[model samples]
Structures are given as structure tokens and as C-alpha cells.
Target: MSQYWELLASRSDDQHTSEELEMTAYRLAVEQVLYYADRHSRTAYWMIERYEREFRQALVPLGIDVQVNRQLRYAYALPKHAKAGTASIAQTVFALVLRAIYDEAASIGQLTEGGEVLCDLVELAEKYRLMSGKELPTKGKLDSLMETMKRWGIAKKSEDHGLDDGEDMAGQPYAVVIRPAIADVLGEAALARLVQFKAVASANDEPEAVTSVAEEGESQE
Candidate 1:
């Protein structure tokens, strides 16, 4: 854990009256990065943008690599030697599907200004069915996956937006708020790979064709 004070001391040309305030801001930025590995909350993001240089500089001494996307208004930290992804295969696939859904929805203007989108459980069930060619998971399993997504800063139950998590929503519509952080987690590179993999898989899964009598004669020749 690198102390922000240490970094500030090393870089401060005018270490006057605002050192303590700046230190507090730097520490808060670090905590924000730790809590939200994808993208910090809006308030935290603004603060991070204001102190982006300090945040990056502080993490360097501690052996942590950080990525700041100014266009997307987000920042995240990477451990010195972090693994590629933090989610299980199922979780990762589900998240990728949500991202695809988000992109599709946004194309037709279904997303809000904050890049937040609402996706119903019924819609998700249909997507899962299509993706796996099987029935949707049990409510318990679905709920568990959603909880894991929430922890990962992917999606969350938005009761304020008329979303619910009870059995009452089984037949009706039940939605989750897909957070903007999902874009940072599953960026363009990963999505492109997924598309390529899907195309290859689809081609491989096609049924084989049988040759007729004329074709057999040609093969014999």
C-alpha cells in the first residue's frame, strides 16, 4: 500500500497550506479505485479526473498500474501482476451478453444519458436461452449471478426504477440497471474477440451434408 503523502512529498514543488487537503483527496481516490475496479461512481470519478495525475503518480511507487480513460471519465488500478479477468466463465459470459444487449439497446436509443440501461429478467432469460440453447437458469441461480454482477460493478437491482427481485416478478417484467462501469470491464477488444469466437463456433456447429449418387461418382473419379 503506497502512502499518498510520500508521493506528494517527492513531487511537491510548493508544499504550502493545501498539502493535507490534497493528501485526503489522493487517499480517497485510491480507495475509490480499490472499491470499484471497473469505474468509480460519478462523484468519485469527478474527483479522480481532477486529481488524475496525483492518482497515477501515487500508484506508481506502490507497484500498481492504473488506467485512466478521460473520454469515458473512469479510472481503475491494476495490481503489479494482475490476472486477465476476475469473473468465472459463466459470469464473464453473462456480463458480455449484457454488454451486447446494452450496445444493441443504445443503438435504438434505449439508454439514458448516464449510459445506464434497464434490462428485464424476461429479456435476459430469452437471451440466455438463445445463447445456451437451453432453458433459463433457476431463480436462485439467476439471483446469485446478479448478486455477483453487482459486486463486480456490472449491474444492480434498481428498485427506484421499478425493478424488483421477488417471485412476484416471475411472470411480469423484472429488470436490472446495467451500470456504465460494464463498458470499462468489457471493452471493445473483448467484445470483438467474443464476436469472432461466436462466428467460428457457429460455423463449426453446422450439420454435415451427405453426398448424392452423382457426387459419389465424381469422388470415385
Candidate 2:
């Protein structure tokens, strides 16, 4: 995580405005910290402390430690409401799907590519274990989720594909272009983690497929 923060901070040096850097730092802190907490099942406070420490390490060298406390406070506050309130598991599942797609794109440098698009929703759902087969959401549900993603600026619709085409059309896929707003907020390392997760998930998926093939071969024998 420290390495990622360093990469983002370095990227920020020439291109980003001071305010943007500050915002990036805060966003990275919140997301990465929460991710660590979620993975380790640690309390949010522990995550906050780790985030602050990493942030300070990342910022102090840049000669911009003045707003560190303010940013830390904001970062720490993000998980408070999330932790106390009940969140829909469906929403969580959908977000994980989005994250996986974002990661896959990033790994291939598609996130930085101008025309790179999102993978189809059905394919994305399958990759993330959200759907067991080619089953897609109803039109209403699909539209609702697409609209939500658009509002968040994590995704947008291309005129290329339509809902009527079913599974075959799923191959045409939605292109996921990274929003500058989110890229600006999250920095490179956090974005890179998405890529990392995609690789791990891909590796995990391959083994299951291999095992399934072996079983099929055994049955044939």
C-alpha cells in the first residue's frame, strides 16, 4: 500500500493541482484503509491509524504535511456511517463486480486508454461470481444499476450494444473508461489494486476450471 501511495504521489507531482493531491490522498486513505480492515476483520480505528501513518509517510517527503490531520479526520469518518448502517448485500455484490472489471482494465492499461470499454455486465457478473450462468438482470434492474454506475462516474453507456441481444451480445461488452474524477480521487495505487485483485481472481478461477476438466476426463475414462 505504501508503494502504491508513493506511485500516486509521484504521478501527482507534475499534473495534479494541490487541492487535487489533497483529495487524492484522502480518498486513497479511506478506500485502502477500509479494504485492509475488511480483509483483516480489524476495527476501523486500527485502519484509520494505519492510513494516517501511511499518508504522513507519503506526504512528508513531498513537503506538504500541513493538512494531514484534516485529511486523516475525513478519511477516518468515511467508514463510520458505513459500518453502523445496514448496507444491501446486493449493492455490495454489484460493487465488487465493478471493482473487478476496473481492475482487469487497469492491469491491461485499458483504464488509461481512451477507447477502452467495460466488459459486458453478464460477463462481469460471472467473473465476480454474481451470476451463476448467462442470466442477466431484468431490463428494469439492468437500467437501474447502469444509471447508478453512471451517476457515480464509474461507468457510462456506449451506443454500441443493446439489452435485446442477450448472451451473444454480451461479448460486445460495455467499455469501462476510467472517470478522471475517480482517477483523480483514487490515485494510481488504489486503482492498481483493482488490477491486482483481477489477476488473483483470474488465477483462482483457472484452477476450478482445470479441476472441472479433469473430472470430466476421469468420467469419460
Candidate 3:
């Protein structure tokens, strides 16, 4: 890996450095996901594409698996054998619902040009009610959970106007854009887990199925 880094450094342009490359790798280790289309992740995404081989070798010892989806133009790090999602019940439920929305839109080709599904809060609320038989957490609680979703590269806020003075917000927009990475991060099996959680939560079983997908590794944001 040291020799590979040296070679990359030698062939690199003055605009980027070996140190930058190393830091970018660390950023991937920490951030877990990077999208080529995301403005904030463009540099890191390019570095990963440029030194794909080195990154795969470097991350292996850390028990990380690199998944580069050229179709979606995103890179994600999956821990080899651990819990892949660390969202609490509220957050996990939101993620699961959002993933469902994304899948539904994708089936109908309703996704944005960038392959993301733009969803309204009302849709989220409706889906949440259907999935868990509970009311969606309102105001700051919902907003905070969205932030966590964005941090984990699953979803992001767009055209958000915050909560209103009252709770009669039927058509208001607390819209979220579901990222393509969500598909890779949470597959069909995640929805299955969501079903599992619903049973657990309904049974007053102490919310046992907190982890979204993985089995052993830490998958939280």
C-alpha cells in the first residue's frame, strides 16, 4: 500500500496530493458513502474512482468492502460482518419508509434525472402510519431524523419550510429527496427487517430489532 501511494503521488497532478488522497480515503472510512453527483462529494468521489484499486486494498484490513456503482455513480463502504444501519426506531422507520417510496417511484420511472425520488412529508406520514400504525413524529423531531438520514447518505431535505404554527399541515412541503445510495445501503432485505421491527414494536418486545440490515458490523452514520 505504501508503494502504491508513492506511485499515485508521483503520477498525481499538483492540484491533488498523496495526503489529500489519504485523507479522502479516511473520509470514506468515516462517511461510508460518496456520490459523484453530490457537490460536496465530487472530489472524494473522483479520488475513489482514480485510485479504485488502492482503496480496495487499503480498506480490506479494516474489514470494509467497497461498492462502486457506476450505474448510480456512487461509492459506498460496507462493513464485512456487522450491523449495517444504526438508526434508532424512529430513524429506522423513516429510512425504511423512504426506501419504500424510492422503490415505488423507481418502478414507475418517477425518479428525478439524477435517479432520486422526491417525496413529500405527507407521503412520508401516510406511509409511516401504514407501516407502523403510529403517528409520525412532528416538528423538530421529524426534522432531526431527516438530518440523520442525510448524514447517512440515504436521503436529504429539499424545499423544506419547517413546521407550521399548527398541526393541520396536509399539503405543506417537508419534502425529502431519497438518494440512490439508499438502494444499495438498504436492499429488499431491509424492508423485510422493517416488517420484523413492526412485529417487535407491536408486541411490546422492547424494540429488539434496532439494527436495520447488517449482522455484526457497525453500520450507523
Candidate 4:
């Protein structure tokens, strides 16, 4: 067996330190994504820059299609055939919210300058309430969803590392570093559809239907 297999077999055990794993480019590429999971992160980008070919050679045979956008300075993965699972309603709503926020921020050069926009959970809830006339997810549920977003590389907790769960976080703002990757994932066509969806949903009071539309749109991608 190759050293890769040896490392894989021993990965679950305490046989290798992070430093050891990062020594090999292939190992670094896999470990960077599997553990840290922000492909645009400094370390991950560095690994991709230095070892992208090795990364592709390693992942392709395993049914993981990897994409490296050199100009954009990011890399990502998709399963073979690129079929994606539909997100839950809450997740879809959260993604839309992020997309809206990112677009607004990008227009004014906030995100373009690498400055992150702060997304207050309380304000987000208020926005959702105003849009849907329905209460947003409870504090705990929203927090859980935020965590999932963090893992998915959509956002990151701010510098202050605000409270994890709070119903009254309106005053205390938590920062989220939104990535440009959202635009890539959502795409321009889907965004146009979402714009229409928002207008119609807002007018017709059918915000719940947004999830189904989003699912259909994603499936076509």
C-alpha cells in the first residue's frame, strides 16, 4: 500500500500529528478540507496553490470532483455526477438571507474590499418576520443553523465571538464573514429567479413556497 493508505488507516488513531499530516501536499489538501473545510481559508488556499495537481489526482479517482479557480483564488469539491441534496426550508431561507446581504454589501464595496459585513441575528429575525409575517426560528434553532452555515463555509463568527444562543441579541451584534463562494454556488440565473420569487412571495404572502422553488432551482444546477 502507498503512504496515503497508511495515513488513511491511521488517521482515526493518534498516530499522526497535524504537522505530520500537513507535510505531504496530498495529505494537506485532504486534511485541510476534511477538517477545517473553508477552501478559501489562508492555509487551504496555500495548500491548493502548492499542490492542486496532486489534490486533483488524489480526489478524482475517489469520485470527488475538484475545481480550482486560480483567478478567484478558491477551490471546491463536488461528488461524481454533481447531484446535490436539497436543503431544508430553514437552510434555504438562511442562504437567501445571506445572498441578499452579500449583494447589498458587494454593491457598496464592503465585501469587495475584504471587509466583512456584520449580520445581527436579531435583525435577521426581524427581517424574516417583516418578509414572511411569521416568527423566525427560535434562538436555539437559528444558532444551530448558523453553525451549519459556518461549517458549509458561507460565514464565520466575528471577532468578538458573541453569545451562542440568545433571544434578545438585537443590541449585541455578531459578525459573519461572508464568502464570495455563495455567488458561485447560487449563480446569477438562480439569483434572478430568487429576485422574482421574493417580489411575488412578498406580494402574495407565500414565503413558505420559496423553499420548493429554491430546491427546484438547485436541482437544475
lDDT (Cα, tens digit) per residue for candidate 1, span 73-117: 555554453344344445555666777777778789887655678
| Shift in Å, residue 52, candidate 4 | 1.5
Return the clash pairs for model 3, or none. 81-217, 82-216, 82-217, 83-216, 83-217, 84-219
Candidate 3, residue 107: Cα displacement in angstroms equals 1.0
Q: Rank the candidate models, highest lDDT first.
A: 3, 1, 4, 2
Instruction: Write down the TM-score of every candidate.
Output: 0.60, 0.36, 0.82, 0.59
Q: Report how far off residue 190 is in candidate 4 (Å).
A: 3.4
Find the candidate with the highest lDDT and give its number: 3
Scored by lDDT, model 3 comes in at 0.72
Question: Where is the poorest 10-residue window by lDDT in model 2?
Answer: 208-217
**Each candidate's lDDT (Cα)?**
0.55, 0.39, 0.72, 0.52
**What's the residue-level lDDT of 178 in candidate 4?**
63
Each model's RMSD to truth, in Å?
A: 12.8, 15.7, 4.8, 7.2
RMSD of 2: 15.7
79-143 in candidate 3: lDDT tens per residue? 67665345567777778878888988999999877788877777888887777666777778888
Q: Which is the winner by lDDT between candidate 2 and candidate 4?
A: 4
Which of 1 and 4 is the better model by TM-score? 1
Off by over 4 Å in 1: 1-3, 6-43, 60-74, 78-81, 160-173, 192-221
